[model samples]
Target: MSSSPKNAMLAEHRNIPYVAAGVTNPLQEFDLYVPERRNTLDTRPPPLICFVHGGAWRSEDKAEHAGLARRLAAHTNFPVAVSNYRLTTASTPIRHPAHAEDLLAFLHFLLTWSGPHTSTPTPPYDPTRLYLIGHSCSAHMLTSIFLQPLDPASDSASRSPTPSRSPSPPPSPVPTPDSLIPSPALLAATRAVIMSEGIYDIDGLLVTYPAYKTWFIAPTFGRLRSYAPWNTASYRSRPGAEHLNWLILHSKGIPW
Candidate 1:
């Protein structure tokens, strides 16, 4: 006989293929682990913890994070989604915003579950209880999306007037629109963020790793310093850097 209903709840669907790929290319995708026992009829749907994998934005793929996604889902009893983004390399060197844009697209797909090749039906979600976690270069991309400036042209309600999305205790005041304009649904629902070994200050990084200016930074960001909005310093003078709850994770001697 089949397992009991409670035991059956621990199910997983892999390689659902969220985005469509061309004849010879791999489209961006995410792996979602849904808890089996969650109540679909509850007043509020379960919260989600989305993870962005890190590869310095130049190496690695989403499948590498399957273990993490599975573990988190099992331990927390929360649906966990792990995603992959394009990487920059010598042969096909992409720039700074490329990763950011790719990740934003992933977020769009997650919230709406309506991409051209989405596999599953839109799962009920507590929009206001969403949390995002990113590691390494992915952390930087997540930060850019979080700290992005609200466009004055769009409806004010769509974007939070308070710019900063950091989840901090209090006090300590601090801190751009672009190709990435977040959806209204996502803006209203996002709650907190966790960044692991994130690269925040770009200019500072260049200053610290002089050779990287030519080897890495230039290839990824180009010579135009002002165009680099990924830098955390760029947000300092802007309004609204205190809207979301934030947690930053770092290891000693990592030097990010």
Candidate 2:
């Protein structure tokens, strides 16, 4: 068995907290790999490549994929960040949307990140150009972040045969929070999304692999009668989704 080559011309910054340390879950951290610049005169900041690891949304950590991040940074000559999110467990009992929400928070942190704030002497990353790569369940989380349900009522109304009527305004005029929603700037800055072996449709997945329900779905989603709301395929694409370059990859040989 031959081992793959390693990239030596890269600097690794491990376990940098995207969220406030000690204030939030310890898993809300990321590892950054910055490749050595070959040309000093270029002066242009390359796009940052962010990798979201997958272990059925219940396992895996950023530290496990350090080698992959180094290889990506070396090949692309770009900064690579492998992020960690809270996992669903019997003890923790974290469910869907929580994992996706963490990813959103991490994105916000990366978009507004300043190198001076960290003691690691981090290299400046270009916020204008960000490429997201998600493997397995992370892909579902990434899709959920960008393609949220715009209006549940409207979707239900559209399914009905009755004539559509104007929706009555809320009596209180209270505004819905945008905390989970990705800002326009964040959406615009995301240049592309690469989904590898992603679970796009929860219902479809269950039909194909019934065993997955016991393996991860039930643990990650809880006892939901219908998985429609959590299905990434059913979500409406956000404004910048049409503009984003999407690449989907799947391995036929891999049996779930």
Candidate 3:
């Protein structure tokens, strides 16, 4: 799925009631679309559903996906939080590492803001469930979480000496994917994660299809490896329906 429709959806359903992650940067802000449960005097902790928007990493707001949050909340009875990321129109290229950094920051905040749970429920909230859900162009949300563990903040040393003259070399698998985000202990605490119309096979998709290369994939991914989030190894780690309560729901009839 492309990032344009995701932007359109965000524009429509931004009128719900919930808390917001105040401006982390000059350009970014976040909102939480709490289900009707937050309205009552409920004692239980509701399950968390985190939504990440996609604008090729440059566009889309947290409020953009609030409708889907409301839908999920109403349907499944979960707490849904949406985040706005930093982006600028001038020289508006979102690039690679920047998007990864933005996502990692959001994830770190959520994990810190709300931790684990125990028991069943006190009154209205449910304790047995804790999940992460991302869809559309935001599929990179889950990808970033999995890839962060393996990459450094910036691989400046890897930059090509002659940028305009020659292209950078392909990425090597040296750092490995687990070196970045959470340790083994922390990973176990995560309940489940979902990606809709995932960009999991991004790097492969770029190389596999000539259409993407001519479009924006070549520039965005930056050579083969080069710390791009869409790399095969990083994307493969994502949990499917069986593994991490993950579900990659296509709109049906889409080629995928």
Candidate 4:
């Protein structure tokens, strides 16, 4: 759905509160928006799009785009949700991977947002057709955590000195014809996604990006590598995964 439909599905002012990231108190609050409308399909079921804010994973909030969410819901004829995630602070307990892990929790919240699975007694999801949108830091979290693969084998001695969200998974030679294919805990079924101005290159960005170095890629999610190389090639080689219909508004396109 486009912006048009999103603006069509909101109340004069509808607000929903959610915890997009963080594991403890003062985690943060997120707001859901629906534009004020009359005789609009706002009441009807429609697609859903979720947005992640950017602040280099250090800070950001849903209010950053609450208006956009409402306008989007009204114009696109879809429901829009924005979320908050953990960030790096100047105080004690500085855990770097906290942001990435928070996203996973948020994703879980999205998947089971409605229906049988909700943190609350009720589900917040309105429909499928999930589209994720992120800018800058949020994009890094979204892509690195959800899309990009890690090298997995690198470690203390041979590990690439970089500020990676994670390390390469420990060395495990690609599965042979005799081995069983590793299964995915999550499916690559995202309808579409948008990322703006991000350090997509995990290796290059991590080595240079200051924020990542401070975050703990090593202590947290682990130096988890990406899908098997074979899997990436196959997934990309497939019809939709390659096309992805992804919109990368950046200084350049993807490598190769």
Cα TM-score per model: 0.72, 0.82, 0.61, 0.58
lDDT for model 1 comes to: 0.62
lDDT score, residue 243, model 1?
64
Best by lDDT: 2
Residue-level lDDT for 132 in candidate 3: 67
lDDT of each: 0.62, 0.74, 0.49, 0.48
Q: Which ten residues in a row have the lowest lDDT in candidate 4?
A: 174-183
Regions of candidate 4 where Cα sits further than 4 Å from its true position: 1-9, 12-28, 35-44, 115-127, 148-189, 202-244, 251-256
Model 2: CA > 4 A from native: 1-8, 21-25, 116-123, 156-179, 253-256
Candidate 4: lDDT over CA atoms? 0.48
**Candidate 1 lDDT by residue in tens digits, 145-172:** 7665334345342222232243312211
- Sort the predicted structures by TM-score, highest score first: 2, 1, 3, 4
* Regions of candidate 1 where Cα sits further than 4 Å from its true position: 1-9, 17-27, 38-43, 114-120, 149-177, 223-229, 233-242
Candidate 4 TM-score, true structure as reference:
0.58
Per-residue CA lDDT of candidate 4, range 1-256, in tens? 0122233435322232235334334344445554443455555444457788877556666666777776677677555777776665555333434565565556555555442223545433443446778787666555544443334354222233333354433422331111221113223445666887754444444445535533633232224343123222122222224434566666554331
Question: After superposition on all CA atoms, what RMSD does each candidate show versus the true structure?
Answer: 9.9, 7.8, 8.8, 8.7
State residue 124's C-alpha deviation in candidate 1, in Å: 5.8
Count of backbone clashes, every candidate in sequence? 11, 0, 5, 36
